[model samples]
Target: MPRRHLHVTGAAEAPLRAALRALRTELAVPDAFPLQVLVEAEHAAKAPRLPSYDATDLPLFTIDPPTSTDLDQAMHLSRRPGSGSASGAGPGGYRVRYAIADVAAFVTPGSALDAEAHRRVSTLYFPDGKVPLHPACLSEGAASLLPAHTCPAVLWTLDLDADGRTESVDVRRALVRSRAKLNYAGVQKEIDAGTAEEPLALLKEIGQLRERLEVERGGISLTIPEQEITEHADGETGGGTYELTYRAPLPADGWNAQISLLTGMAAADLMLAHGNGVLRTLPAAPDGAVGRLRRTAEALRIDWPHHVSYARLIRSLDPHDPRHAAFLQECTTLLRGAHYTPFRDGDLPTITTHSAVAAPYTHCTAPLRRLVDRYASEICLAAVAGTPTPDWVLAAFDTLPDEMTEGGRRAGRVERECVDLVEAALLRDRVGEVFEGFVVDVEDVEDVEDANEDQPVTGTVQLESPAVVGRVTGTPGTPLPLGERLRVRLTQSEPGAAKVRFVPVVPVDPVDPA
Candidate 1:
């Protein structure tokens, strides 16, 4: 019998549709709040004070996606002999000056904008559009690091050694104007072609230096291909799925590493110098992740060094190969959770702090989009200015560990709901059909254990395609390794319940033998 495409209808809607909609509505604040009242209170509390701007003459430029509007940062570079080195100011040690828009300049304390910003906490990124923090007048205009417009900014001047490690960090208030606004793809092309412009040339140089620094410092990084959906004008997918694979090339990775190295260095300096502040995303290492990966390697006949960093292996895995895809899925078990913490004058506790960055770092980038960044940036500012951290910022630090976590949970729910809706809608008609699948799990319907030994009493396995995890009924055979492949017939799929069940189609001989 010819298999027809499943056309599953929702119970009027996906189960999570209502829940997601409710959460979004609950979390979303009006785009703009009346500032007259807040502004008056702000002015009454403190007179307008602005940071010094001095880079207007230099052609600082911003390169972001074409659709990007909340431009938060701009950059320019100048090369000279390392102050004392004899490189003669030509292709010598370079200075990377990143001009971050001084958002604190406009959003004064105890004002309407500040209150609204606090309430919203962070910008929400949705598939269709984004919910911005400040209005366009500021986030996209005055406070934006737009091209050719001199703007007030908090400048970070990093002195790099021949390697990318910062010899010193010079933070100051400056006035700067950008030369051009470019995007990642364009800059990538320019780098690849080797015909680099003013900014691209600097980016290439710094990026190379940073890459070497990371490798030397025992850092592990991965280049995963992310898939994005785009509009397809012709065919069955006129509005179908299109996957976007981004090669985080040397240039991009280098650029990112430079930023990470700088931020991590800065964060370390601050934490050492000051007694207290909040650090972002520190998850305790997942227990038994290594053992599980070792088992996975043995089962799949893949050679992974037991002592080698998992991140390094992931980076080397070929994205184009089928085994790599399956291996990537298996590796997901080893990836641990992340967290935010408040620290006082004490030894830097050994914790899982940004495994990807391989550094003790905090969220200080993208303040407009991340709530923690805004708060952390303020902490950086206060520490830099040598003033007591503001009461509000301190309060935020205390409350954030919960609020942000809750916010993230809500965001995850919404995203998962959307994905489920799309997948259920796609698989509506394919009931009872058997498909080749990887065995991600074989556990009891209750008491599922995690890497940390915490038992999540649920019979579930996460799948790749439709990309979901749900409860399963039968407990296949023992010694069934997680992430093993098998043929399973989709017995039933309940869109309303957001449920999917699979029955193992027993094979004459074990299909996936090591």
Candidate 2:
């Protein structure tokens, strides 16, 4: 790849320059309210305590991404094959327990820390860094499930069969001390090499069970590839490196599957027991997905099965090939918006369990990074301990949906803005340069029912194919189908707009379509 720098000598009257500077300043100091005072207030406020168990004896471990520090849950899975448990292939089967961190114990309700946590509500992931929900001193240290540090946790012991069905479950509050901290890549490598450690063996077994369950259920999802941008030393007078990376399925997805299954099972149990609670939600695939997918499949010349598993299809696609970019882009349309809302007396007729996990799920893994998890953990703690639920915790149940929904939106906006800024910056210096690109997606215009008669038209774009969407410019009136070859001229480049619109160039002697 040819390396080039995009300079930011803004045009004489570019409004973007001012906007970019203002955004830069905002990014400089992430808005984190002071939390120490709240921490003190929480400690001082008297509250009912749930009886604690000395589970520090049971060994636990946490596995996560390399850069993750706000550790939430931990696990230790053991098999009881001949111990009278079902073979685990059918319902009423028997499997050992999977434990998670009980965050509520450390963070008392109504504390300053709790208040600050509610305000932040979730973690903000910027390319440069993150704005943590809890202070590192606590999230990564005191409250974290770091090995050898005894911490209170909400533990779920699920009994399952060979087919990955949960027969029975037990939730409780226990004091735990993790045995080790493993990263996803390293553990995955170990699993791939067939050199399994004790923990990896258990993790593998649990992952297999979860995978089986997900495939059986109608949980459809896509394995979208993400690009990582780093400052390359020689690129811009010694800045960083920008590289596109993909995660292998094993241990990365496997590890996530284990945690998600654990959390989902726990969430389901809580919701079932309470008769009502706010659920983490995502709607089913959109209405036009099937037709759009058929068109995309035709564009790529890939067969679409009469019965399709979105996750299975995605697993078959290659992210390294630019050809797959457009396909993945096309898949984005199928994802419904994720939201949170409260439900009383099992009012939610249509449960919006996560589509990826194929089960009832909630945000309970990373309390230190998300506001909702803290309260959810508390609910689980109270229910498991059979203790009277705390007043503040109950109140959190009612308000968490609104806070979490808002937090999610904020996080998405911040992430998109950051990516736009960087991509725009990268393209600012490449104005007027021509590059070969692909036609990754295309859409048809449509009208919608409008309440206001003044404006009754709304046009939506659909993805044409599963290929890389690229910008081309030079000439007009040329047809560019998915997977078609094209060269384009870059007329205008606006980093702020993240805009690199191009016009298709036509050859002197064009081949007619058959």
Candidate 3:
């Protein structure tokens, strides 16, 4: 649920892009695909392995950000023939057919492209651009599930009962085409206007039902507002300026996400049945964490009745509200412990479930971008086909977990650094200015040997405008007031160090040294 989408405009765009390029070098992740990998990808794009079964006429369509080129999934939704009766006939079910890009079909084991994917692990999306897992020739070309473009894929057919519970699943390699490529805003607009067709309307209906099912299953999904940078062009100066803002996610975003979650759950179920595969796991939150959150709600002055569960409480809050945003930010603590767990040959890990999902889950949805999904797809295929999981894939069980962990670490490093750099840049010119913000998180600096009991502690402050979150502290021996709006003066803004600091404003300015 932690998300950041970057945007650049004006003079800052060039400098930010340059800084990002430098940061990529510092992180040791190259900006372009390796020559050998690109060559292999190109060859694979033109003449590679293909699937036998074809389902191009299923009227499947893709939904993604308008700029997404390495499209990974396409789906077709429809009502199952019958289910409302005792004999199991009439409105009792829905069928969701999802198509995922078949990256494994093109990247042969031990090939240059395959090795490169293992090294990259996953696509690294930065503020300006992305370091893709595979070359464009493969990721954005032949293998991409572009609209009207047939591609090799793993097609998943999920049959769900009236309550949106998946009753059965079928998955296999197939050649499929996405009839149309749609964006969330457009589809949502149609839905809101009551002009949506069956496919689009069904997304809302089933997405809502699946959501209800999730709550019943005790799942948690944080609709964390996305922090984004936007640029506004200056007319007279012929330049642009940047502003960081928090954009609440649209309902369509969650609806589409539920479908992917459904697929991951199905994949996890398949692997567990066969006693093999990697699970996206998370240890359940400690019992006291909920107590802490209730306290957080109290601090933020939001009512939390004793009988209402955290999931329900979360759904009840409107993220656009500052107090609710602060609460949601606090809620991320419950899911911070998630990780990938792998096992094989009936050797299941002790923690087989993802706490946030409250269900067994795997990452099998986005094969084009994630290395693990390619492997998970292979496992799920073998599990369903009654064939042995590929030798290469089985062997990867040893290192894939570490590989994914390292990959995620690198991505996080880049993201944190990118934000630090941009936030510093945005505040550099106003280092001595004060901004209004609310404290969303607080961390107690341990009572050290020389420190006092009431020593000032650090906390995160969400700025009311420009939407930046930075460190804020109080005067010595005074912790920053939590969950309350206060004017914090920007005391330090060092772009080179990618650091920024703020402190509660003094009522009166100090005497000028000059």
Candidate 4:
């Protein structure tokens, strides 16, 4: 589940834009903020409840998409000398200084902003734009870790061994200023060219070590290209246009993510040690979803040995390969099992780990965009301080699971609809043309999920040219092959409804009578 970015290239965009607007209206997605919320945000922006400690001299830097403004987390990476103690710096290990935006400092508990954040639960992202969780005055201004701006942050100091095993951790409130706001491509360019500063260079080293550590721990961090929408202008061409394409995942993206993952794991360990906190958990992917992924891999012509775990297969993939990219996109289904779960009084949930992470994890990062992170960050801060978890946070935990679950559902719908709208728009004129596709899914394992009263036939087909997946219908009782190449014709491409359909092109019989 990768987030999509929108850029400007050129295509007729009115219809798709109108459809997206309609979808937003239909979903009753929150639009402009109420007057009171905006007023409170602006007031809080000028006078935030600043933390006592100051660490702006740490020279932390942030990594995000270049256009990002709601900066949440920043970090400074360096090595610690050996102390010889098991819990001390493990023989010239590393230290990660992570600064997370202290959203709680601005949004007081039980205030309008807090209530609105709880209502929204999380930010909703679409290719066109994103519905932010907080007003821009704070999320993008006072609370953001934008370069040259001192912001209140929950700074984490994590000590790791030479092989990337965490040795110790410390978390506290501090004021931080990011030295630079960097992007993946820029960082990668610097690292590859041997011009990266010590911290940037250390990122490549530690990120690779963390990746190896992740695989050994049974994690599956997939590298999937995000669908990008950009508009192109001719300078004289006034008509609005757009283009949709996938941006291949870069090594820098993975490296940056590993640092975030490292912090989350550290947060989880802290919460578990304290015996009170909420965790971002995921149950194991269902059999059906895994089977679908297997079919997708075969369709991509990638061999999957029966004994090779999907995690291993995913790790072996070269994400730049278009076939691998398609298969990775299909992994969104595998990630559907994720959710937030709260625990307290030394009671942990039955499933405390994310299946994909293969370890206990918590969302203590990205508070500017995610609701749970704020809550989780508060718990960690109070925990390290040896204070009781806030009463309000404990009260909110009762409903955090349900609220975040609903938020995730809305996000999933938005991602799916946007992809569907783009696919339909791109294929609208290609109806009736036969295209090669792979049968990546059957209707359902036990029965046809889209069965009509008269006939039962439907499955998902993946088209290669444009990376479109649609319902592939066939004659009565003829279940689509699970993993076979087939000829399919686009039958319906309605951008307005975000609908697309395909039918298998049944080969005609020749010379029937002898």
Regions of candidate 2 where Cα sits further than 4 Å from its true position: 1-30, 35-51, 83-99, 233-241, 246-251, 307-325, 345-358, 387-389, 447-479, 483-514
Lowest summed lDDT across 10 adjacent residues in model 2 is found at: 459-468
Instruction: Give the number of the best model, judged by lDDT.
Output: 3
Model 2, position 190, has a per-residue lDDT of 76
Please tell me which model should have the higher TM-score, number 3 or number 4: 3
Measured by TM-score, the strongest candidate is 3
What does candidate 2 score on TM? 0.78
Clash pairs, candidate 4, are 7-229, 7-230, 7-231, 8-230, 8-231, 8-232, 9-230, 9-231, 9-232, 11-242
lDDT of each: 0.57, 0.57, 0.84, 0.82
Question: Whole-model lDDT for model 2 versus the true structure?
Answer: 0.57
lDDT tens string, model 1, 335-392? 4466677765444555625565566677665665556666666666667777676777
**Tens-digit lDDT string for candidate 3 (1-514):** 1278876555544555567677888899856777888888888898868888979889998999887889999999988766553445447789999999999889999888888899999888876668888898888899999987988999999998877888889999999988999998998998899998988789998999889889989898788888887656676664456788898989998999999999999999999998888899999889888778787788788999898888889989888998898899789889877788888888889999998899999999998889999999999999999888899998888888899999988988888888887888778779889888888877745425556756766788888887899998777666666777778889887555647898888642222323
What lDDT tens digits, residue by residue, belong to model 4 across residues 381-427? 87888888888889998788898889878887887787787778778
Cα misplacement distance, residue 365 of candidate 1 (Å):
1.5
Model 3 stretches astray by more than 4 angstroms: 9-13, 85-90, 233-239, 445-454, 507-514
What RMSD value applies to candidate 3?
3.9
lDDT of 1 at 126: 42
Candidate 2 lDDT, 325-379, residue by residue in tens: 5577577666647666555554663765765556667766666677776666666
How much is 204 displaced in model 3, in angstroms? 0.4
